[model samples]
Target: MFDINGGELIVLFVVAALVIGPQRLPAYAEQLAVLVRRGREWISQARTRLDEETGDLGVDWEALDPRKYDPRRIVRDALLDEPSTARRAAASAVVGIPPAASAPLVGPAPYDDEAT
Candidate 1:
């Protein structure tokens, strides 16, 4: 994220080595590793808690993958929940669409210059 390249990394290592000294570098590295491990454990615990809460609500926690945590995916899934007429009517109401229309009115579209 910081965009540190190989040269910058080498410089950072040199600076760290100098400031921390050779003897204390290993100790500091070990402490840093421990902190990273603890942070990961905390994240895992939080995820587990979230999973439990979702499961209690009858949600499939396994279906909720972190990599697929896109707002578009959530919206699409909500929209495609049911193919039945009654469910579609309910969905249309939720989305502020009139049940008589096949598509929702979203205001006038811009004229396509290339179409002519």
Candidate 2:
């Protein structure tokens, strides 16, 4: 997320080495690693507690992902029932209209530049 490259990492290491000195750098690094591990553990515990409190109910944990959690997926899934989606597709097929042509445009068409 920070977009740190090899050169940036080298620079960071050099600066840390200078500031903390070679003898103490390893100790500091160890402490930092421990803190990061603890933080991750705390976050996982909190998520577990929240999930327990909510009782999951009918929610599918298999489909749930912490890294890619999206609230909209729940709403979209609720709206687009499998049978209704199939019925809509079948109705559209009977009308001989391509599904892509029925979708709404979010903005002006790309070819508008050429037209102008």
Model 2 misplaced stretches (Cα beyond 4 Å): 60-116
Q: Give all candidates' CA lDDT scores.
A: 0.84, 0.79
**Per-model TM-score versus the true fold:** 0.47, 0.46
Which model scores highest in TM-score?
1
* Residue range 25-104, candidate 1, lDDT tens digits: 99999999999999999999999999888777777666797876889978878665646788768888998878887344
Which run of 10 residues does model 2 get worst, by summed lDDT? 100-109
lDDT of candidate 2 over 1-116, digit per residue (tens):
99999999999989989999989988999999999999999999999999899885997776776867787987777555444555656766888867665444455446755664
